[model samples]
Target: MKNQEVADLLREIAEYLEITDVPFKPRAYQRAALVIETLAEPIEDIWKAGKLEDIPSVGEGIAKKIAEYLEKGKSAYLKKLKKELPIDADALLSVGGLGPKKVKILYKTLNIKNIEDLKKAAEQKKIRNIEGFGEKTENTILEGITFLQKTENRISLGFALPLAESLKDQLLASKRVHTAEIAGSLRRSKETIGDIDLLAASDNPKRAVEAFLTIAAPKALLGKGEKKCSVILTSGMQVDLRIVKREEFGAALQYFTGSKSHNIALRNKAIKKGYKLNEYGLFKRNKRIAGGTEDSIYKKLGMAFIPPEMRENLGEIQLAEKGSIPPLVKLKDIKGDFHTHTIYSDGRASIEEMIKKAESLGYSFIGISDHFGHLRIANAMDEQRIKKQWKEINAVQKKHPKIKIVKGAEVNINKDGSLDIPPAVLRSLDYAIISVHTNFKMGKQEMTKRICDAMEHENILVLGHPTGGMIGERKPYEVDFDEVVLAAKQHNIALEINSQSKRMDLASPLAKAAIEQGCRVSINTDAHYPDSLEFMRFGVGIARRAWAGKADIINAKELKQKS
Candidate 1:
C-alpha cells in the first residue's frame, strides 16, 4: 500500500470521528492526513529522515504526532479513535446507501458496532424504530449487508488482474501442471467481476489438484480441494480454481470464460451438432470425445476460435459466421484524454502533473476539465477562476510545446436542466463538457431535454458520461437516446466514453447507437490522478466491443486534425 492509501484511511477515521462526536482534533488529523496523501514524497521516509515539517500539511502539531507515531510505532490519536469508534466502522459504511450518520446512530442508539450487531438489530426490528430511521431504510440496510456478504466486494479491474496473473503463475510453476490460465468474466474483460476463475491442465489430474491445494495462499482460504479451490482475499474478493487434463484444457477454458448467455448459445450450437459441452469437456454420442483443445471443438462445430473479449454474445457469433470480428482497440491507439480533473477541483493531482503523465504516455493532447460551479464539495470554480486557469494553461502549453492542453470544464447540469455556467461563460472555454451531476429524479423525457439543452449549445464540445449512474450505487435517469444522440449529432457535440473503471459510462450499445447517429466519440479517462489514466484499457475494450474504429473515436489519430 502507498502513503496515499494510508492517508485516505486516516480521512475515513476522521469522518467516523465526526459522526461519533469524538472531537475537533480528529477532524484536523483527518485534514492533515489528506494533505500528506496528496504530497509526492513518501510519508514513512519523511518521518525517518526527520523532515516531517517539509510535508505541506504537516505543521508543528502534525510533525509532533508523526514523531510519536514513528518512534512508538503508533499514534496516540489513532489509538484513542479506535477505542471510541468501532474497528468495523468503515465496513458498516460499505452497506449500500448507509452513511456515517446512520452507522453512528446504530452504534450509539442501538449498541450496534459491527455487521453481526447490525444484522441482529435489523432482525429484531430494533433499527426501524430508531428516530430518523424508518422501516424502509432498515430493510435497505439489511439487504445491503446481505449483498455485501454474498458477493465479492468490488475491486478495480487493475487490482484484480494481477491477482489472477499471480495465481496462474503459481499454478503453472508446478511440475505436473501443463497449462494454467485465468478464465470467467475476467477473461471476457467485464468492467466488474464477481469471482475469478482459474483453469489448469496436467497429465496426472490427481497430482496437479493436490499441488494446487497445497500452494501457499496470500489470502485466506475459503475452500481447498482437488478439482476446485476457493479463497477470499483481504480485500474481500473470491477466486475459484478448476483443474482439467491437457486435451480438455481449451474447452474447459472457454466454458469457464462464459457470460452465461454466451455459454448457453455455445451449448445450443453443440446441441445442434448432436454433441454436449460443459466446463469439464465435450462429448459425442453420449460418450466423452474431443475434450482436449478449444480449436478442435470449434472446428467440430464449424467455427473458428473466438477471442475471449468478443464472447459477450453481442453479435459476435453472427460476425464470426461471416469470418469477421472487429479488431481489438489497444491502449496505443489512444492519443488523448478529455475529461480529466486536477487540484482545481476534487482531484489528487495537479494540472502540470496530469498533463505530464498523459504526455509521458505519448498522448498528443489533454483537456483539463475540472468541475464547474455547483459542486461546492469539489471546490468547483466559477467563471473568474476558470478564466484565470486559462492563463496558467496557456503558459503550460507554451512551455510544453509537445502537448496541447485544452481548457475545459465539466459543467454541471443543474436542477432546472441548465448548465451551471451561463452560455456566454461556457463559450469562452476551448472545450466544454456538459455532465449530469445532480437532480436525477426527472424521467426519460425531462432528462433527455436536460442534457440535450446543454449539447445544443454550439460551444459545448462533448457530453461527459450522459447517464450519471454509478454501478451498484445509483441508477441513471432514464432518457430518450433518439433525442440525446440526435441532438449531439446536429450540434456536432462528441459523446464521452468515460474510462473510469467504475463508470465505463458509454456502454457498447449506447456507443454503437451514438456512432449510428453520426455522433463522434471521445474515449476519455476522467482521470483524477496520474494512476487513473491506466483505466483506458476498460474504455478501449468497450469501444472495440461496440465495433468502433479509429475514425469513430475523437482521441484517435484520424480525429487529431480536429483536436
Candidate 2:
C-alpha cells in the first residue's frame, strides 16, 4: 500500500477509537500515522533514501516505528489495536455525527461490529435505548448504512488511466495478443470512470483470456471468459478485458469502447450505408464484412476519420462530412498555463517551487492565478496581498529569466455574475481568469446572463473552470453554454479546460462547441501545488477530445516565442 493510504487507514482507526472511548494512546498513534502519510515522501521512501530525519512528520518516535516497519514488515501497535478494537474502523464513519469515541461504546457495549450488526441494532431499536445513541443518531446510522450499500465503487480517471496503461503493456506482451488499446470512459478521459475497459486483438481468444487470468497482483478476479473478463482491484476499481480476432479489431474497438449515445449514432449511420454494426464486427445486411481500420470504417461511411474525443454525437459526424472538424490539440503544443495556484493561496507549494516544477515539465511560462478575496477560506488575497505575491514572483523570475511568470487571479464571479475585482485592479494584472463560485442554483437564462456579464470585463482573458462542478459532489450550474460561448467570443475571452483531476471542466463537447463558435481555449491546471501542475495532461486531454488545436489556444505560441 502507498504510505498515504496506510496513514488514511490509521486516521480512520483513530476516528473510530475517538467514538468508541478507546484509550487516549490510540489517538497519538493515529496522529503520527497521518503525519507520516501526508509527507511529500513516505517513511519507507525516506528510510530507503537515507533521509528519514529529513521528513517533517518523522519525529524520533515515528522514525523508530518506521525503522521497525522497514526491518520487521509490520508494526506491533497496529496489530494490538486490531486485536483489541472489535469495531470495524471504517464502519464507524457510517454513523453520522457519532465519531470514534461513540463508536467504541456501540461496539463494546452493544456488540455492534460492522454495518450489518449496526443496522440490526438500529432496526430492533436497541441502538436508540443505548446511553449515548439517541433516536436521531439511530436514524442517521440507518440512512448512512443504506447509502453505503447503494453506492457504487468508482475510481478517478486520473488513477485508472495509469493502471490501464500498465495493464495495456502486460496485454501487449502476451503471445496471443496482436493489438491492445485502452477504451471506454478511460479513452474518453471522463472525470470519473465506472470501470476500465481494454480491447485486444488476437487469434487465440482462449490463450489471451488465460494470459489475462494468470497475471496477478492486488486484483479480485470478477470473472473469466473467452471474449471478456472482469476484475475488481484491491483499490475497489473494476476493470474489464475483451479480446477478438484481428479482422474484427476495429469494429470491436469502436463498439466496446463507447458512450451508448455515440454508439447508437454510429450504428444508425452504418445502417444508412446498409451496414450492420456490433461488438463482433460490422456486416452489410446479413452478410459478414470487414473494415480493416477505423479510417476504413469512416471512409466506408463517406466521412473523414473521427477522433475518439469527437465520437460523441455532437455534430462531429456532420462536421466531418462537411470537412470542418476541429484539429485536435496536443500536449506538445501547450506553451504555458494561465491559471495555477501556489502557497500564496491554498496551494501546497511556494511560487518558486511551482515555477521550477513547470520549467522541468517543459513549459515556457506559468501564471499564478490564485484565488482572490471572495474565497478567503482558500487564502484568497486582496490587492495588498497580491502586490506582495508579485514581489515574490518577480524575484523568482529574475533568477530564472528563461521562464516568464504571468501575474493573474482566479477572481470570483459573484451571484449575479459580476467579477469580484474591479476592472482597474483586474487590468493591472497580466491576465485574469473569472469563475463562478456561488449561486449555482440560478435558472439557465440567469446563469448564462451572469457569465455573460463577467465575459464583458475586457481584462478577463480567460474563464477558469466554466462549470463549477466537482465530480460526484455538485452538478454544474444551469447555463446556456452556446450563448455563453458566443458572448466569450465577442469579448475575446478564452474558456478554460481546468486540469484538476476532480474537475476536468469544460468537457469535450462543450469545448468543441466553443471552438466551433470561434471562442479560443486556454487549457490550464488549476493547480494548488507543484506536483499538481503535471495534471495539465487531463485538461490537454479534454481539449484534444474537443478538437482544440495550437491556433485555438492562447499560450500555444508563447513558448515558441521564448525559444
Candidate 3:
C-alpha cells in the first residue's frame, strides 16, 4: 500500500475511535496520521529500516499498529474497532460537515448505519428531531447527500492519474503489448473523471487481455472480450481496457479519447471531404489511408494536430485548421513557484526545506508566500516575524546561490477591500500575493470590488486562488469574474491557478478568460508542505486545458529578470 493509503487508514481509525469514545488514543492517532501523510519518505520504508518510531507523533503503540498494517493487509486494532462499531464509518463521515461527533449521534440515536439510512432519516424529518440537528441542519444534510450522489461516480484527477499510470505500466510489461496509453477524459486532463479508459496497441489482443486480468486481479470482471475488457478494481474504480492492432491503434485512440463534441466535429469534417472516419481507420473512397498515428490522422484531415486537452470543441478545431494553435504551456515551462508556505505560517516544512525541495525539482527560483498576520487561525506572521523570515530567507539565499529566493507574503484581503499587511511592509517584500480568506458570503459586486481594490495595490503581483473555491466541497464565492479579469489586466497583476487538488482555483474556464483579457496567469501549488510543491503539474494541466501558452504565464519567465 502507498503511504497515503496507510495514512488514510490511520485517519479512519482515529475517526472510528473518536466515535467510540476512546480517550487520548484518538488524538494520538490523528497526529500520527498527519505526520505520515506529509512525510517525505514512505512509512513502509521507515518500518523496513526498523525506525517506525522515528516518525514524529508516532509512539510505541501506533508504531506497532502501523507495523501490523504494513505486514498484513489490515491492522488488528482497526479490525477490532470496525467489528465493535458495526457501522460504515467512511460512508457516514463522507457527508459534508459531518464529523465523528455527529456520526456518533446519528448512529446511536437514529441507528444510522450508512448514507442511505442518514438520507432516509433526513427526508423523514427524523434528523431535525435529534437534539443538535435543527431544520436547517436537516436541509444541509440533504444538500450534502445530493452533492455526494452527484460526485459519487467521479474521481478527482489527482486520485485517478497515478492509478492509470500504474495500470498502463502493467499493460506495457506484457510481451504481447507494444504500446499503451490512458485515454478518455483522463487524456484530456479533465479535473474529474468517471472511469479510467486505457488503450493498447498489441498484435495478440487475447493474450494482452488475459495478462491484464492476471496482473490486476480485479475484484470483479465486468466484461471480457478479445478487443475490449472491463473490470472493477479493489479500490472500487472501474477500468476499461481496449487492445487493437498497431496499424489501427491511432484511429481507435482518436475515437475513444474523445469529448463527444470533438469527435462529432471531426466526423463532420471528414464527411465534407468525402471520407469516412471511425475507430478502425480514416478512409477515402473505400481505401484505407492514415491510421497508424495521430499526426497522420490529422494530416489526412488537413489540420494541425490538436492537443488532447484542447480537443473540447472550444475553437481548437478552427485553430488547428488554420495551423494557428498556440503551443500549450508545459510542466517544464514553469521556472518558479510564486506562492508557497513554510513554518512561518500554517505550513509543515521550514523555509530552508522548501527551498531545497524546489532546488531538487530543478527550479531556478522559489517564493515563500506564507500567510500574513491577518489569518489568526493559521498563526500567520506579524511584522516582526515577517522580518525574521526575511532574515532566514537571506541566509538561505547565501547558502543556495543557485536558487533565487523570492520573499513574499500571502496578505489577506479584508472585508472592506483593504489588505491586512501595511503598505510599507508589503512593499518591503519582493512581491505580494493577495487572497480572500474569509467573508465568502459577500455579494458579487462587493467581492469583485474587494478583489479589484486589492489588485490596484502596487505591491500585489498575483491574486492567489482567484475564485476562492474548493472543488466538490464549496462553491466559488460570488464575484464578477469579468471585472476581476479586467482589473487584473489593468493593474498588471497575474491571476493564480492554485495547484492544490481541492482548489484548482482560477479554474480552466476562468484562466482562459483571464488570458483572453490580456491578463497573465501564475501557476502556483499554494503548497503548505515541500512535497505538495509537486502539485505544480496539476496547475500546468489547468493552464494547458485553458489553452495557455508559456507567454501567457508569468512564472514561466524568470522573476528576477522581470523585477
* Top candidate (TM-score): 3
Which stretches of model 1 miss by more than 4 angstroms? 1-14, 21-83, 91-159, 169-179, 202-219, 271-300, 512-519, 558-563
Segments of candidate 2 deviating more than 4 angstroms: 1-154, 173-176, 203-207, 214-219, 264-277, 282-292, 321-324, 382-384, 414-425, 438-458, 478-487, 559-563
Span of ten consecutive residues with least summed lDDT in model 2: 34-43
Give per-residue CA lDDT, model 1, range 1-563, as digits (tens).
13543464566656667677766766576657755644444566678788887665457976786667545545677677778775577677767657778887788788887888888888889988998988988887887777677544665454456557766777787776888988987777666677788888877767876676665332578776666677764335677877777777888988888878888988898898889998766788777676677767766777767778778787777776676766656679888888888888877677888888888788888889999887887789987888888888888888888888888888887756677887787778888888887776677887888887777665787899887756545555689987888888888888888877557788777887888777888888788777577667778877776677787888886334754
lDDT of 2 by residue, 106-176 (tens): 77788877777888988998888888778977886776666555433555565567667767877787666
Each model's lDDT: 0.75, 0.75, 0.86
Per model, state how many residue pairs clash. 3, 12, 0
Cα-based lDDT at residue 165, candidate 3 = 79
Q: In model 3, state the lDDT of residue 474.
A: 57
Clashes of 3: 0
* Candidate achieving higher lDDT, 1 or 3: 3
Q: How well does candidate 3 match the true structure in TM-score terms?
A: 0.90
Model 1, TM vs. native: 0.78
